[model samples]
Target: MDREIAYGAIGARLETKLNETGLSRNEQAESLGISRSALATYISLERIPSASTVARAVDRFDIDPRWLLTGDERDRITRDQWVAVLSAFVELKAIMDRLFKDRIGWHQASHDDRMKVYRAGETLYEIGGISALNACANALYEGNPGAQLGAGDMLNHLFNGIGPWRA
Candidate 1:
């Protein structure tokens, strides 16, 4: 199979497992010890899951790794499922927009910088769902420079992987 097809199969299987668990995306990410963005990337077939992530998914979700890599006919994503996933991504984009709205320099920031912020927000969402993301945004929106500096520093550390905090 082609690499992209394999990844799509794996992503579909992962999405199947996620649906089986009936957990929210944030809860699923927390259980898998990955950022929500990582999960999204996997589901969107933008990236393959790492070995460790696959292992964790196999163990945590009782999924057969082989089946995950090459899903059978039963595992295919239906049109409704695909639509639902696209809808979720749209909602996520809306959330990201809200996260950056009214923030200084957000409009002027480069695309890369915007992506960094989106990634940071996704990490925060994994940590504490929407509330955590909201807190980060609130911190930035607060007129206090110190709070904004702290939030900015936290986001920078998260994006660069140069901090004591793991998440």
Candidate 2:
């Protein structure tokens, strides 16, 4: 099978595990050191995760890389992974809304809705602001300075336990 297709299947399978374990795609990706977009694609069965990605799943979620890749959710995401995802979401939110006001517009529905779904807590500021702010966090986290998620194993923990919650 094609790599993308494989990744997509794994991604879809990963999502199944996430929902069973009550995790969000954004949260799961961060814990595994992958981008949120990558996770989203995986969940929709549109993309596949790399080897390192699988390793991250093993290290963070404790779901056994072999099984996770092969479409098994017999295991659950570790408590440690859960904490990591939550921290990432909190850290990202703080930066976008409070620290970086100049970068966002602060709109509704599209932006905030996604934010609430992915990041969790306190209704989103607005769509424009949410996206801009989240993009800032994304670029900053995996790129430049102020990468709050930190560099290490179990990076996906940065986004765990969050969902489209009312603020």
Candidate 3:
């Protein structure tokens, strides 16, 4: 599908999900950590939600990122996969928290440092952030190395092969 058309379809699905929530638009926007106008734009297919926005929505609403972006939620991920996803999210969030904290203290970080954080966050989003991380984890469990390789590679580089975290 073309990008525009796919986004429109995703937007339509978003609208349906929102309606199913039984919340007003403003309330939904607040819950999603976005402005009403931004949500409206997404519903109207004027723009796609960024990875950051998707992550926030996943967190705030307990959404499934795959379902939110692709409208498929029946597939189940294994418990181990869910653990991996959560682990990835926590690791990525910690890195981001540290980056921002340093930036705040020093007024800025090197461009490379900032880009590392940006790319890592984007990888998290691509792997469904906290919401859809399970899907990627499940794929990995099945020996699929091609599940969002950018995310997989970045995670490997940052977390050293997704083993148990130390310290």
Candidate 4:
């Protein structure tokens, strides 16, 4: 297949994932670490995501890269992979719930303090069989209308240089 045609297929899959997450374009952009206009270009099939972006999506969403790129619906991930994904999510939820138990925003914390927490999150993401899943969940919760104050603020803090864990 031509590269453009393949990109179009991938773009369609990206659209489907975006709809599945029920997030607005801005939220999706943030989750993907891309700008809104970049996402727009992707959705319009004007350009494809970079390799890093594609890898990020796979890690962040538990997406099967093969299916994402080729539109092959067959499950590429093994049962073990699925289990690991679920387990990591459960662990991450526990971790976040514990970290935010006080329900006070870490937004006001110093940079070093926040960086410590952000580093923790990054470590867990690397070693816990979950890649930026916590951030994805945060973005998801933040985007949802019913999400309250304690949800999804970590990513914002971390990205904005404030970090995520409580000081």
Candidate 5:
């Protein structure tokens, strides 16, 4: 990953963890032996967290260090899960292409907007499997009440349904 993208992923993961714990920012920072401002910087992606900071978070919260940095749990995913995810990605891409082509013309859509839709589909798949993913796609394709929302709004709705575990 690019340095900035990696840092952003790490920050997102850290923020997810902190939110999951439901502890005050000051308390979480205190447990990690860092100032609240420092913790804020890390979560805001303004700075890369040091190795010790990562380690402390790993130990304090029982987080997988790899997941904290990479947003993946390779060991936890079985072969079947990989296959499902890959299949879902392919299916989602086709659906999104068609949907965007009809609505805004896929070629005219910004790359970032397309990525948001794909990411939202992936998150839905993770949470409730292929059925959930398909449901979201169907909603968008069928012209549901919220179907007219922009990519960012659709992303927010999809992400709001995700639990902390899926983060």
Candidate 6:
């Protein structure tokens, strides 16, 4: 996943909020004491803006930080956490895409091979299983929603013998 693209999307959302408030980038820069170019970068999501900068923009325009960071002010996630997760999820999705490809590949399509792919996909999705069967079951039950877990959990599940204790 390209972190830069994610950051840029957030910046564009922030710029949208400012536009709706009738506030220009120059004004926001002057008021926040940040460089206009920096503010522009924030608008472009080219750079991850600080929490304080987000707060200032929110306070100044009476907007919400969550909205600026995630394009959804109503989302409950914090600004920084959302940014990190957004990048992480983008990467996770890429991993999952590979897994999907493997699932269809001839080598991994046979009974044993498909099972292997499924077992490995389980680790990527964080359902540490004692064996291929166990992992396959978990992957089925948990469905794709479980894929939201972080890479650490996925790695642990994939490599570490079952759960944390078993490992």
lDDT of 4 at 32: 93
Cα lDDT tens digits for candidate 3, 22-98: 89999989987889998998899776665556556656655665666555555644445434445555555455446
- As for candidate 5, its clashing pairs are none
Higher-scoring candidate on lDDT, 1 or 4: 4
Model 2, 47-92: lDDT tens per residue? 4454446546756655544345443334544545434444545654
Instruction: State which candidate has the highest lDDT.
Output: 5
Report the error of model 3 at residue 135, Å. 13
Which lDDT tens digits does candidate 1 get at residues 1-167? 21222434567789988899989999999989999998998898776665457657866877754356544333544435433423433443444455446453445556665665555555443333333333343323334545445445444434344232344
Taken over the whole model, the C-alpha lDDT of each candidate is 0.54, 0.44, 0.53, 0.55, 0.57, 0.47
Ten residues in sequence with the least summed lDDT for candidate 6: 127-136
Q: How accurate is candidate 6 locally (lDDT)?
A: 0.47
User: Which segments of candidate 6 are over 4 A away from where they belong?
Assistant: 1-5, 73-167
Which model scores highest in TM-score?
A: 3
Candidate 3 stretches greater than 4 Å from native: 1-5, 78-167
How much does candidate 1 score in TM-score?
Answer: 0.40
lDDT order of candidates, best first?
5, 4, 1, 3, 6, 2
Question: What lDDT would candidate 1 get against the real structure?
Answer: 0.54
Clashes of each: 0, 24, 0, 0, 0, 3
* Alpha-carbon runs more than 4 Å astray in model 5: 1-5, 76-167
Q: Which candidate model has the greater TM-score, 1 or 2?
A: 1
Better of 5 and 6 by lDDT: 5
Q: Write the per-residue lDDT of candidate 5 for residues 48-140, one digit (tens) a residue.
A: 565457657867886665456556554644445434544544555555556656786544656775565556566545634433443333333
Which scores better on lDDT, 3 or 4? 4
Name the candidate, 2 or 3, with the larger lDDT value: 3
In candidate 4, what are the lDDT values of residues 73-135, reduced to their tens digit? 544766465445445445444545555665545765446655555554554343321224333
Off by over 4 Å in 4: 1-5, 79-167
